[model samples]
Target: MTQKKPTSRRQFLGQTAAIASASLVPFGALSSRVSAQSPNERPRFALIGVGGNGTRTAPVGQQFADLVALCDVDAKHLAHGNGLLCDGKADLYGDYREVLAQDDIDIVQISAPDHWHTKILIEAMLAGKDAYCEKPLTLTIDEGKLIRKVQKQTGRVVQVGTQQRSSMNFFNKALAVIADGRLGKLYKITVGIDAGGWSPEISVADVPEGLDWDRWLGPTPVMPFRYLQDPKKDTDRNYTNGHTHFRWWYEHSGGKLTDWGAHHIDIAMLGIAAAGQNNDPVSVGGSSRHDVEFKDGVPMQDNRYNTAREFDLIVDFADRDVQINIRHDVDNGILFEGERGRIFVNRGKLVGKPIEDVATKPLPKDAIAKVYRDMPIMGNDRDAHWANFTHSIKHRTLPISDVHSHMKMLNVCHLAGISCRLDRTIHWDQTTEQITGDELAASMMSRPYREGYEIEM
Candidate 1:
């Protein structure tokens, strides 16, 4: 990977402003923050692995971004994101390290799977560029702490793609209601994600062309390409495509635990104010029940994903408790049970006691401004999230969904998944962010990185 000297703030913002004004692209209502460059100037960024979510979301990024480069291990994703660049001059690369190596890039939007997140983020910070990495911040607890350390030491702005923090209806409302005691001491939080407890037995097969299979397996142990081929070899669809069912595999994702759990449990933890404090949870407990056996069904116990297909994780948070559960169903949502009454919130729905409770106080006007972070739109708009990132870049301000807060939220997701994986009660020293008793459970916090791919502090 080639490393370019860091670009001066003036030059970076100058390039950003030129692209923003000349593009004249339609912006989401969130775009109201689009033009607010600090007196200093705007920030430019690059997109890493612009596939799936990144591909769909990067266009809206234009409202607040000067897309300078696009990168991916797969040429397809790299070319795709570059095509969305307003300047039509954005450079392209197949390896994200190359994008991070460039000193001119102010930010890197990481939309890779859970396993790839930590490596890309650590490298980007070391390269001096701020980062906008996506959710389930890391694959393990140790990696989360290491990334947190780098963020603090580097002083680089990091906005995890946990967009719920910026959502007015979910995060803002939940935070306010809890703080105001509307939830009346907030007894417990129950977060559930639906999934069918099903997985086909793994089988061997050939690797496809164009993909550097080894690169795709970065930081993860190497395996025969057949280890992940489609269970039903009759089908023409190869399961290892960049966008294949990655969420189901442990090497690429944490299944539902990190998938919806990252989103739902994050909101749940935020409402309870248990995020980021290592001394938070004194004990953790859980169970994971899979419908099939590892040798016959999934090949490797934790390869294509050893994450729980169904499980209940409980965390003791001093004054309160949190129950995180995953099941195979589509009716997903979050429920908060307090002394007063219970509140249920999910995408497109918010219902609770008195029905009027949410509207009654409506986040005091002052709180509204502060909680919404003064963004024009108060929801998870890709454009809005990107707008906040770009705005912060020039203003030298931290975005509301910053790495610290996101990492705090991510800790819960990682903890929940860890609890399920261990399937036993365990003690956690939140302040130290370490497991107290079980060495086996503690060992899973981080995994061995492939050669030349280790993420260092």
Candidate 2:
């Protein structure tokens, strides 16, 4: 649990750089890589889902690991990554399974859609590859459970890209306020994640050339490609409902709930822990706005964005006497109100009476460290998040955004999404991590994968 803070960005990079240049060291006798590789050799990584974020991640990943392969179902995206991220030399594939098949790949970085995250990550670990995956690590509550099981079985190191926890000093500082008792008995958390983008009527369109529409819809049901032509260029992908536009559909993602929720909501749970409390909610219920009508959480129409465009969810922790309201109208930050005082934080700034009082009333020196569970803030968010992952790969320890904590918070987000879909309050038996009372609601916790793509849990 103890980690030394890197003195400088240069020093951190130098240490990470050693992973690639250093001589091979024993990863373990049990590793499949025993003959061909070691734990110390620069991990050869396969980047999956090369979209906008994947392109941005490539350069950062290369600073610590080698990018030897890339995969994306859309040929256009694959080409973009090939030219820009890999300079056309990394072996490219349309199927991620193929990339995982390569013997040389020791690591995987997944930026795939939320629906695909669990399957890919579980397989990567079972295949003996450690990985780093983007946030909202699971599409459903069951998915998170399945992933936790696999992680424990495989003993693979994985990190979730919930950057706010790493990059935003303000966020951790806000958690410190509670840990330091600047906030007297914490009572409520108001999270303003805002709303998802709205889309107009989408028309069925021919699948774009070089894109495998089938594979892109991997685990979701087969549906026609739908899109709205660019208003200006007549070539945009804005409302396509796949590729760049999948987040708008409940079939692919939880919209802003998981999109931004994975970031802020995850921090909110840590804030719960900072208050010396557990985060299991006894009841989750809320109202949400969908562009289309719904019957039992299933959208009645297909042409419009179906995920909640706007929502307000209430998560109650009855045992702890705490409540969290995830709303669209709150300022786009977490407003933590306690009996003593209040402080608000997002990626930008941390403020309020508690923060102001900090000038004179310094927080407990170990407050932030306690919330982060002892990992020293390395450098910038980018430096620390990545550094923590690479450091874990070398030390064979869990990274900062380890699967366990990430999934625990993510389950709350998934539960909220289910509540939005069903339009009713659902009780949770936190002891079993199961939905209680409503069978229909309980069923929504996990979806049956389209036949061929089923995950082996």
Candidate 3:
């Protein structure tokens, strides 16, 4: 590793002036002070899971780091992602472990399925690499704990792919207004996620030619391949889309609860945190209706999707004053209802009288910067998340979406899924971090991994 030179007096004064102007929080406790690297010394990056989301994030990684390797369970996906790189020059691999085995890669991007996230993230950190993992960071509540433990042990930089954290318009602006007390007293938060449980009826068929199905199903139970052909092109044998369709299954994902819940729930928790409320919910209860019948939490029909089609969940915080209601029927977004006024935010827009009032009654000058943990507000720029991750790796600082807060938010999503699955109210002991009373509900917190794929501490 190259050692960075000492900062000049002029550079220190400039940094001091920037911090003073932004009204930024002191970074002494939030992150470590490591030597910053030069632009010419860009880190080497290896990307795993070149499916839809993976393909999208690859170019972003290219913008900050050298694209050294691309890995995917499907050969066609790997080839496609590699082609998107600068002159298609990076090496390609069918297995992610092979990419991690290399000593030169400094950053690993895990954009795989929800089930594979924890395993890859842990292995990447253990291999001495910083990571940028997509959200719904873990498949279960237990996985989140394990990832945090490993991250602490390794001291590696990890940025969860909850891009909203870096967005200036929706999340940043919303938090700024809330923190400024524009919305007098936040009483309730409503999050609406997309409805799930649509799986076309299909028969068992052979795995496609270019895909390594077993590897793709890493950590998931071994099951027969269910053929899913594109409705538009009936004869298309390529099951690329089908391979990534695991999100609809409970075994692989928590449906829309974790899918969109990861994003909305995160912002909800951030709002709660900004308002000086405990981020973790103490009690969660919900009811769900699935397209297929579930027996002992497993769907009866394996041929079609099993996750809930419609559901409503109510969450109570330790603060007692704040309550969260999650539903499937409403449009996909978050609504924060407070004593003074309410605001609604999603990927597209952030609106409400409170937000509108900011024109005449602007936030307390540095409120936006404060919401971003003292960083400058980069409005509507999607690349800010990637930039933050890379900047953290270079400076050894905590990015906006650090692992600890991400896990806390994910816990709420997982609890909601478990409650909806059992159709009962579940009590949670936040101090102990366990589900109370119902042993069956408690068991859902973590899952038994397949023999070779279990997450080892």
C-alpha lDDT score of every prediction, in listed order? 0.64, 0.80, 0.80
Question: lDDT per residue, candidate 1, 1-457, as tens digits?
Answer: 2234455545544543443344333222122222344645545778887678887666666555577777777766665556555444677766676665555567788887667999888777666677788887888787877776766655566777767666665556656666666776566677778762344544555655656778878888776564454556776555432354666766667778788877887777776762222225567666666543443223344323344677766767755434444343435877877777777788777787723665654656655445556655523646567667765654556687777666666666666666665567777777787877888777767778888777643
lDDT agreement of model 3 with the native: 0.80
What is candidate 3's lDDT per residue for 142-212, written digit by digit as tens?
Answer: 88888887677666789999998988867888998999888877899999987875766767888878988
Off by over 4 Å in 3: 1-37, 230-242, 376-381
Give per-residue lDDT, candidate 2, residue 352. Answer: 94
Q: What is the Cα-based TM-score of model 1?
A: 0.81
Q: In model 3, how large is the Cα lDDT of residue 455?
A: 54
The better-scoring model by TM-score among 1 and 2 is 2
Q: Candidate 1: global Cα-lDDT?
A: 0.64
Residue 63 lDDT, candidate 1, scale 0-100: 58
Cα lDDT, model 2, residue 407: 79
Poorly placed runs, candidate 2 (over 4 Å):
1-40, 230-237
Clash statistics: count for each candidate: 13, 1, 0
Q: Using alpha carbons, what is the TM-score of model 3?
A: 0.89
Worst 10 residues of 2 by lDDT: 1-10
lDDT of 2 by residue, 1-457 (tens): 1112223434433433443233233333234342245646676888998998788776788988889888888888877788887778888877776666565778899998878999889877766778989987988898888888767666678889887777647887888888888887778999999988788898999998998988888888999998677686655536788776788888999888889888888878788878877677788898887788988879999888888888888898854678889998778989988888888998789999989998998977877777776876676576678877877776677788988888778888888888888889888887899999999999899888998887633
Tell me the TM-score of model 2: 0.89
